[model samples]
Target: MHDIAPYLLQNDLGGESLVEFEHEEGWDLIVVNLARAIDRHVRHQAKIDPESYDLDLIYFSQVKEKKGSLRAYVTMPDAIINAYVDFAELMSETTCEVTGRPGLLHTKMGFVKTLHPDVAAERGFKPVD
Candidate 1:
């Protein structure tokens, strides 16, 4: 598993503020890179204090309506909500729904979807399996 502790600390927040998957699992490189990109964008463009916000969660799952489509959920403070959403939409073209491939050339919606782990995995995101 990749250690995200150092990255989380770089944001000036403790590990406790992050979801468990951020600490325990070996995420796809695309996911890690996206996190870093969002972090940089939020810090540089939004100019928000890291301590004031919490990265409540970051995870991957399948899009039920669109088979083989994957979605990434990244929850943070409302203060930087627009920035995160914009970034997600912009990055959607470069993100692949299946296999977690990055830098693909395609357009899609980037809004985060809320789904149970079992449902997501069964739908084919299957990060845990």
Candidate 2:
């Protein structure tokens, strides 16, 4: 897992060991996207109300059965959970599990359904046919 401790410390999230996993081929991009999403959410919230949305606590748990699956546990005062989930869903769509394809066309829905069913319902997410 590239030692998420450094990243967390750099972001001032404290040095709390969250989870560990083997580093996969394309997992770096996924993590980058997730961090971006969370950072964006935090910045936006800070703009709205600096005092209330000051702290953001999020942790990731690696799902052993699923190769590239990372479950996020968020503990923020605001409703930014959906934002993180949405970014995860988006990353899942872009990542390809098989040969020379642009996207994971077959497993997109199943991924979102399994990981973030509530997000799917909230965003009216459906298969891109």
Best candidate, lDDT-wise?
2
**Model 2 ranges off by over 4 Å:** 1-13, 21-23, 56-70, 97-129
Q: Residue 86 deviation, candidate 2, in Å?
A: 3.0
* CA lDDT, candidate 1, residue 106: 29
Q: Tally clashing residue pairs in candidate 2.
A: 0
Give the C-alpha miss distance for residue 127 in model 2, angstroms.
18
lDDT of each: 0.39, 0.45
TM-score of 2: 0.48
lDDT digits (tens) for residues 1-129 of candidate 2: 333323322223555454553334444556656656666666677699887656434344331215334344444524565666556645655553222123433224354322233333444555334
lDDT over C-alpha atoms for residue 25 of model 2:
41
